[model samples]
Target chain A: MEPKRSKEASGGSGRPRGRVFAFPPSPQRGVALYLQVADQLRGRIDSGELAPGDQLPPEVELADGFGVSRHTVRQALRHLRDRGYLASRQGKGSTVRDRKRGLQVNPVIGSINDLVQFASETVLKPVSVVEEPAGAEVAELLDLEPERSRVVRINGLRCERDGAVFGYTKVYVPVELAKGLRAETIHSVPIYAQVERNSGIEVAGVEQRISAGGADEELVEHLGLEPHEPVLKISRLYYATGGAPVEFAESFHPPSAFEYVIHLRKGF
Target chain B: MEPKRSKEASGGSGRPRGRVFAFPPSPQRGVALYLQVADQLRGRIDSGELAPGDQLPPEVELADGFGVSRHTVRQALRHLRDRGYLASRQGKGSTVRDRKRGLQVNPVIGSINDLVQFASETVLKPVSVVEEPAGAEVAELLDLEPERSRVVRINGLRCERDGAVFGYTKVYVPVELAKGLRAETIHSVPIYAQVERNSGIEVAGVEQRISAGGADEELVEHLGLEPHEPVLKISRLYYATGGAPVEFAESFHPPSAFEYVIHLRKGF
Candidate 1:
């Protein structure tokens, strides 16, 4: 509870307030002392007690205040730095970074295929195509007999107007529906449109779910991001006009790159 | 290009691989050379080459491998240890923790109001509520007349079956629609259902987007995670039966905790 107090107190005082060690230091229960300190400091940061760019107390001073070694203090500072909440410099002490600038929150519906067609401009960068048996989830969505679903798994990068990697999408169309479409065609037009044109299937209802994850190596390389960067993962299901599942796809995007927007109005 | 090769080569051979350092170590970057080394290792781990539980060569051997001081290797190991990626012991060497087991992806939808009537059972934990003027995005969703828009901002945690903190949701409803609904009611039932029951409006259509991000301190606490853990952020817009925007909401979830599924079928 008090971990946040120091930060809020520091906000009003500007300079590292003398009460930095105001919280009662609890018994260290095997957990690294610096980690405890970092936890406390992080609490303050989240509570707005310590504003972004606020300099932390000198390591030696903080060590003295918390009755811990400077080594321990450094550990705590380092933890904050890796988490993107703090940044350190040689001449200057560590300062809080703008943590809120990248915070993203959204609601989950069912899948992304429902929304992918809405983009005014979309581009795809093909990575690989493989044939794989459908997983249980995929099989259920496509309404295929168990083990009967053979899918052409097409992996690619999707970009919006600015050419930023909005998502890394993996589209799975039943090989039956994908009969004549080559992997090369994915690069030119939206795969959904291609599937419709080639298979003569009109997509209708869709279900999707949205969640969060870290970028893997392949995604990092394609999206031009550091490994482990937070990314948005969207899984979508597209249905035919008769309500039969036609395709299943998943996509990922860096959190800072885009925000999902929806318009809703009151009902009469 | 080479990075991927190195990753594949190391990954294919099950042996611990060292960095390919240039001859003659350069001056240490002020931030600590070991940290730079650790960043590379972290990338490898994320790439699935250095899998969970994989052991690194002894610290001294790793020092020799990267052409750095043993102390530098120790420093790098210490960084990894703090991140929940690697575990180290005094006598034993460091091993990777199994982070892959829990990784999750966030989708791009923005609000929870769209899910208010979802047949799935709902659980809500209200944290706080406040009144605020509609921001540009919120105003647009609600189709408000500029200065006339007011909103009730309700923040809460939402979980599905089995007690997983699947999402931290924040809903913004036009003040008029939120009337008669006590903040306390948010904890028991979906607020939209309550709004409809009290005001007689039915939600019909919805729009949403999904994105990715890291868990901040508050999220870390709410979701019982380490600071900077990866999470899914969703933004959503809820519509009334007549397609009017009734509410706007956003939610965040631990990526490893939930999977978003979509089913797509060809259109006729």
Candidate 2:
């Protein structure tokens, strides 16, 4: 539907495309008309259609383009400015804030096939593979004993197709399972698949825990994230044929780099 | 097995219990002995047993306690400090860094029953419920037209027992289905359930999109999160039996407050 013009909005073509969304004016419901205008403009800024430091059109122009009164446009601009989407000073029209657009990686995590698909889509860069004493928590998760079991810790970065990092990964296996393991295999294949191939024991189950927290300084540097930026922390335990956890893996995902999706049927 | 301790360690009864994790000092393996000590100590600090601002035992005392050389104790201290887990200076003993223990809520999200379970476990406190003009994205998600539809927006917070805030929730329903939706009913019942009950339509499927990003200033204030704290963003669309969209809800979960877990058995 064409936006009814305020008679002057049709005169301007200099504004960057998509910056001025022109749908017919929304019917004034109980909520103020200015709030809708603010939200739509904020959506553009949020999606990066209006980049950092990009100046919003003059109030009269925005007022005309939205087919709203100049007073309403002033109110909308003030709302966005208060929300930090725009920076305004005397005589200088609002400029979009330098807020970074969020980044995310969409990974499916339902079954083993999904694991294989995820592995094929991304490459693992092994940072280190060495034997470390597993503490009580790690021992319990991987089904090892703290006193007798020293686990092989395989740490790495999972990278996207263009070499952008997807996340930092830490995988652990009992020392017995690591004796003949090659770092190359860990980098080239999904670790659980390799475990099943090596031990000839089918993986019976996968338990996943997904949580959120901030990146430490070292992790922030490695993931190229802002310091103290929050991250998605996902850890999985792979069970062998009889409920023995053969592998434990944890990944720290920078939001700009990874996300997960789940679809469920109500009848299921 | 008792920790093999040097004779000097036997004299120390003043150290706080659980602070000195006395697992039989791990068998010296490929990694450095000092590194293993660092890891174990780091684990304690990470789990908050050695709380923020807690002081580490003196070097000679720690050396005897772990049955290690004073030099090794110093090295471990230096490692912990380098990793920002310890605060060390010229003369004082090392102290655990003031790191806030990471927080999370564990939610199961693979079925509609899980939603029922989730709602039953938490309480929602409504902030506002009003008809707002649906933007294009909201319109598409809720199956409405921007020009003709104003969605009933219900905004609230899900709270845990003892009144801790769980997250911020925003739910939208098409105005047609929203007629006579009581704010009291919205607060007490899950909106999707209310839709199913009122519309006489079965919720055929639920599609969920999970992503991550830092909270805005207003959200930070509402959720009691530190400035720029990252959050788990979960949005779900509820579809009717014939695939008509009926409800769209999104929640911003603070990691310290909530987490998601999924269990997938193999051979499905």
Candidate 3:
């Protein structure tokens, strides 16, 4: 959208200047003005008209361009930043941050390992492997008929560019799936692929839940964040062919570090 | 743990005693002293001995009780607040805020209809709904085969107790999902169940992605917050029994008003 040049500067007289915003006409009623502004900017970003790392017009320029107050522009920027679309530095102006181009998956897909690989290019950092009793939530997800499922828990960090830990994941695979794979395998290969290679079972579906939280001290230390930093929490369930639960995993991500994208199309 | 009291009160000489602290034996060497104090307090809270809404002892008193400096107690309190266990009110002292209970599921489920019940519970106020083309991301989630998915977008404010507009949500459901429901249904029933009732297809599973953000003006107005308020953003997907994608949703919540929780257990 073209920034609105000052009417006084353009015409110099009382007569109106004939110019329409290249963007859609601002809605007249219902939604608040700043939100309408935010919506417009969000649409532009999603369409790639505003690319990542591109600096936004100054607040004054945006306000003038949109025929709104500087406060309104700031409001829109604040919303975008919180949603991971933009970042602002103290001296530098606000720059577009990538909010798209991350993971997209059907929750009920093959294995947690498959989902992770499909979600992003993965770099794994092994933490530990241990055995423990299935918790209430884990048992429910695995469909274990009392005392039937035992899991080998693998804790690790998944990273993208520069080894920045986008997610800290803990995967619990039934003991049967862990056969032949020692703790050393966790560092060498993706667990889901290993399970398939050894057991000859393909994963087909998955389930997942996502929520928000603040990092505790341990998480902050691992994520290299200051205290009180917010993070994303996700839990996923993976199933093999015919719907047998095979893996359950939970992961956390620093808010500014990642984006989860989904493509919705018109259909039944 | 009992407070380690000094056995002799400096012999009651009335002169200033040497600055020697009487503290319990330290557990592990090399651990930060303040961290140890913080852990003890955290344990009390986790164990339910320090219940939510209970006021913490004054920093001076706590420091004296632990035989440490007031700065140490402040550091611990700050850590607890950062973890969401306690919140400080100026002049009123710090009170436990039940971090676990504060976490909740983001209400933007699959369909706009599903949102109605959540709106009522979370006190959602509608802003508007508009028909729009499916963006690339939204298109993929609905399984639209290349430029196929058309969607109806709904926007609104979600409030918490005390009339604060805690967050904003934008829901996009396939146009078909909007067929049987009117805008009024949003105030009366959840849209997900409504979709199931109309289509005879039960919603079997859901997927969600959550992250933290800051509030914009419209979000602030709706959430009754100031500019730059931190919030949570969530994206969700809904599915049917045959593994068909049904709905896609995104919602946001302020940090002061909402928290997300998951019950986790060890699997064996």
Candidate 4:
């Protein structure tokens, strides 16, 4: 069947009914009917046929315009809203929303030097320094005997030039190699450099684990995040020669602060 | 200062308050006093001294035991609660919660073969396959010019052998390279193997991005996640010889389903 055009788009009816236009046939493709509607609407918005600040037609009118049920219309609207395209209220109807671009930092690191560069871009100022017996979590990360091991814990916030906090960072260094980081950190230098300079321990390998989670209370206060915000949590273990982990660092990055990129080749 | 002892823990009181143990000296180490309390309490839990289902002593008793104020005790309890260690209510007091171990999959990928192995562990069952014009997100992912490029989108859920959903996946393949994925997919086989076998287009390069995001309503319904749960999001772009993107795939993995492990050596 031919694609259906709304009365306003065809110009074959009375005054134009505010941007109602042509949409694909329902289930014409392999996608669901509601998705087809959502896709078509999204395309229209992308093409600027339906500009931001435009109030979408009422659900009843949209149902008629798309030649589908009101339920389908609601589903399509909801799909858009969930994806940050439109906003709606109980009685106020739906309106296209202006998309706000948030902060995204892409840290592409393949070596310790690269990580040093990343660290130089932002400062990790120590919030507290405490020597404590290793907990189960820290011990496992650092490959230490929980009861026998002690670590100098450095808790800090990764800050911007203006001193705005974007990340909550905690680094656990074995008490043996912890002296370098104990001195006042040069806000611009990387921790690895400080450790090497202070203790002569060289990091030869790194193991990184990247994951995501909800911002808990401490993070909310440190990162100034709204409750339930998604955070990018990265944990890294730095190894000296002979495969002993020298330092374990983990950072919690809110959406505004985290985007990690890396490349993989088929063959070395 | 000597760590203060509570009247009951000192054996100089009338009744034994629930379970008030001696805590460490506040701020003895570099850690904050409240964090010290939290760490000490967490250590007690880890050591099985305060087992799950044990209600913590009242705030006043804990304060007296730790030699900190009731405010600090409350903060320490709140910290534990936020980290999934304890549960509390206004009048119900706090109880050590039984930590449920969730499912964790560690995909250690150094090459396409490793990716195939990861895919073999779980099945991607298609929910919808639609051939449509690429949206901006898809176009950018595949490096396609939005207006002219078309892609065959395969939307699926990653499931376990028993058919339990753990992740939501979307794969966008340029129309020319999509034929392989259109066939009746063998759930055990990886997408890379299928596309290479059917279309003879080998994946020469892979670009991977790891990030975190909130579980939108759509994802909640797909992954059976609680509202506002954290999700681990992964995006991969596959390139053929000479580096044009052949496929762009992204997956949203709830915490129960995602853990990525990678290694970085100083020298290749």
Looking at model 2 chain B, which ten-residue stretch has the lowest summed lDDT? B100-109
After superposing candidate 4 on the true structure, give the runs of residues whose Cα lies further than 4 Å from its correct spot.
Answer: A1-107, A145-149, A160-165, B1-109, B145-149, B160-165
DockQ measured for candidate 3: 0.05
lDDT of 3 by residue, B1-268 (tens): 5545433332111111212322345433345556666777777788898898888887777777776667767867865654456778777888886654432122343322333444556654668888888888888667565356688777876665355666677777787876775788664455566677777777765655656665677677666766654567877777775446677777787655565432211110
Question: Can you tell me which runs of candidate 1 are displaced by over 4 Å?
Answer: A1-120, A131-150, A200-204, A241-244, A266-268, B1-123, B128-154, B159-165, B171-184, B189-209, B236-249, B255-268
1 versus 4: better lDDT goes to = 4
Tens-digit lDDT track of model 4 for B90-115: 56678886543222111122444446
Lowest summed lDDT across 10 adjacent residues in model 2 chain A is found at A98-107
Write down the lDDT that model 4 would get: 0.71
Q: What's the CA error at residue B17 for candidate 3, in Å?
A: 99
Question: Which docking class does model 3 fall in?
Answer: incorrect
- How large is the interface RMSD of each prediction? 14.4, 13.2, 13.2, 12.3
TM-score for the second chain in candidate 1?
0.51
Q: Which candidate is the best by lDDT?
A: 4
Q: Candidate 1: deviation at residue A90, Å?
A: 54
**C-alpha positional error of residue A70 in candidate 2 after TM-score superposition, expressed in Å:** 77
> Which has the higher lDDT value, candidate number 2 or candidate number 4?
4
TM-score of chain A of 3: 0.56
Every model's DockQ: 0.17, 0.24, 0.05, 0.25
Cα lDDT of all candidates, in order? 0.65, 0.70, 0.62, 0.71
| RMSD values, in order shown | 24.3, 29.9, 29.8, 29.9
Count of clashing residue pairs in every prediction: 60, 9, 35, 3
